[model samples]
Target: MSKTHEVVIVGAGFSGMAAAIKLKEAGIDDFVILERKDEVGGVWRDNTYPGVAVDVPSFTYSYAFEPNPSWSRTFAPGNELLDYAKHCSDKYDLRRHLRFHSDVRTARFDESEHLWVLELASGDRVSGRYLISAHGPLVTPQKPSIPGLDDFQGHVIYTMEWDHEHSLDGKRVAVIGTGASGLQVIPAIAPEVGTLTVFQRTPIWVLPKVNPPINRFASGLLAHVPGAAAAARLSTSAATEALLLSFIYNKQVPFAVKSIEQLCRAHLRSQVPDPEVRRKLTPTYGFGCKRPSFSNSYFPTFLRDNVELVTDGIERITPTGIRTVDGVEREIDTLVLATGFKVLDVPYDLHGVDGETLLELWARDRKQSYQGVTVHGFPNLFLSPGAFGLAGPSLFATFDLCHGHALRVIKESRRRGATRVEVSQVAQEHWMEKMRARVGHTIFNNPSCAGSNSYYVDEHGDSAVLRPTSTVNAWLAQHRFPFNAYRFEEPSAPAVSARRRATRAAR
Candidate 1:
């Protein structure tokens, strides 16, 4: 039998690290962090494709408490982000709590023991009083269901698991999917590849990027100056929040949406000289239907003589190349799948009260939670980014808000000496209804977004990912949400006390 811990956190990325730090700060030290990979950085550690850099500014991307003063660029590269993760791990002593290469297969709640039991891929079991799922939605890569893809003879690479061993220099390459990953990798490999063909299912709104180097003097000021880092973070956060709000409240702020559309159109017109090429690159959907990307080079790469953009629908993959519905087969030496991740899908199995699985509950009803942190049936389980949980574009801010709410519950449980804590079904239902109404006003629900193919919309055709509320309101909700909404229960059985004694004795 595995010894039970106070808390068990999955994924050692920024979210897990933040949870661990908060737990320690709250004086709860008996916690374990389970990481599937050997390293700490989650997406930054995995995605090493060429031209992989953050779309958001570096200042806002980092943790508020621990800001890096030496970011070389406005938008830092993936490697630098990984280095920051390592630095944070060492600085916070998180390595001691981390269990590397521990892949969680399933998590089931043990009602009798009032504990969450995690079964790992290695057939190991871990028990914890509280479970925090820090693994993000983008962890699982989504492969395009193109027929005859396995029949391809050439090397196939996923953007998530990039193969640096095989050189792409002077090789004919074909990239599928025009999402964020596709946008970044296309420009990076275009200059090196012999001939590049980009297959686009849907066009993305591309805005001009303003990435400037932060020199030594500026870096020093940000580091040594008392208010410099705070000021920078504040300004960047404010700017991004304003932009995100305009999208969330498109019905209320029509002018902001129109302004953004005009700016994107002007940028596309300025970059691509050919009118026909520009038409193919432009998105018919309204701005913010899908997440917009920033790149000065993506549009210009199409102008290159070696690059070709194919807007035709993909029919199937042949032995040597991809065949479009237009009946053209573009032979290529390598196939790069820049297809995005399964954002709306849960990757692992999770069982809650009375053998009710999370998948079953979501399928029966819909993916929802009280605060995007806690669900009704899943007691003592907290999700960092739950359904309708993400508060803003900046993931760091969302982590702060979500984890802050989780910590409050954990602290309250400790104070009340409660062994089990779960949100009331009534409370969850009320929250879900409010969220549904709020999401209706966002641009995602607009008629223009019907063909956007955005991950924000779930299987039920609801925009269930984003919180659809302002960041300020999210923070207020975290602090001011009534604790009475949860039902806290103390240990009622002798077996539970005996189990705790056994766990302590084993430790």
Candidate 2:
């Protein structure tokens, strides 16, 4: 028999670390955090591209409990953020509880035993009373399906899995996809590359990324002054949450949209003076239709004589170059794929009760969950960025809120001595009915999203990513909502009997 733990957490990233720290705080330490990678930091650890940094501001990106006073800038770089992750792990002594390189092949709930049994890649089995899927949406990297990609002769690399050894100095480079990664990478490598060709599938809204360093005085004030950092975090959170009004509340973004467009236009006009090029770079979609990127240097990078921005669609990939639909074949020394990740859909397999997989359930009913955390058929299972709950202007805000709710449920179950806790189908239905009704009113459901090629909207053309609620409201709902919405399995007969005898003997 495999050793059973109180909880088994998959993915030792931020979410997993948060869960572990919260569990410890709750006096529950019999949990194991399994990470496939050799270290923590999830996407931060994986993505080490030329100009990797967070899109969100630094103050609000961090956890409220562990504020980093030494954030170098308002938006810290990827390495700095990764260091913060390591610091959190070290601070909390989470290393002792972590199992590195322990990749989970599959997880199944043992109905009769009331436990979650996970199979590792090394053919090892681990059982636990509860299971938490902390592997976030952007864990898996995706490459575009282009013909002759495998036959490409030169070096091919992904932004997530960056090839650090391969130098781009004076080398002709062809970059595919102009998403967030593309926007960041293009500017960083343009000055070094001999010739750079940027393939734009769709133009994304680019805002001014004026990242000013947090001065030493301010850093010291935030660190030394009581409640200063907290105040800054609150201010940033409020601002981020304010963007949600533009995202879901208003059918049109109103003044926010116009103001943002003006800023983008100014940025583009100032950087790329050529009218034709500016027109080619401008996005036709609404402000919040697709993920808006920010960068002061991105638009200006194209102004370089060696850089070429190609708007034509990819016809096919040749042995040495990419042939566009316009019959233009751009020869390349190396190919870099900035092609984003699989967000709306997770490729990993999960088996629940009666050998039913999550994919099968989603296939039958469409992918959804109660409060974007719990699934009906999956007992003792909690998911991050599940279904409709994935969205938040600040993902960390969402994570903090969700972690509190999940831990609350776990604590409630433990208090009741329950063997397992499962969300009822009726409860899930109630939440989804309300969520979908609210979805119709949001901008995500708009036709503009599909036109923008946003992954936020799923294959069904419905907004699958966002939770359609305010961040504060989400936090409140998690705290105020009734845990009775879930069904808790009763303790074993033997345990109950033993407890009764002990009580009688004490009397």
Query: What Cα-based lDDT does every candidate model obtain?
Result: 0.91, 0.85
158 Cα displacement, candidate 2 (Å): 0.5
Candidate 2, residues 314-394, lDDT tens digits: the string is 999999999999898989989999988878454457897868788787777777898888898899998876888755557
Q: Say which candidate scores most in lDDT.
A: 1
RMSD to the true structure for each prediction, in A, is: 1.4, 3.4
TM-score of each: 0.98, 0.95
lDDT of 2 at 198: 95
Candidate 1 ranges beyond 4 A from true positions: 500-507
Q: Write the per-residue lDDT of candidate 1 for residues 229-297, one digit (tens) a residue.
A: 999989888988988998799888878988989999999999998999999999999888898888999
- Give me the displacement of residue 153 in model 2, in angstroms: 1.2
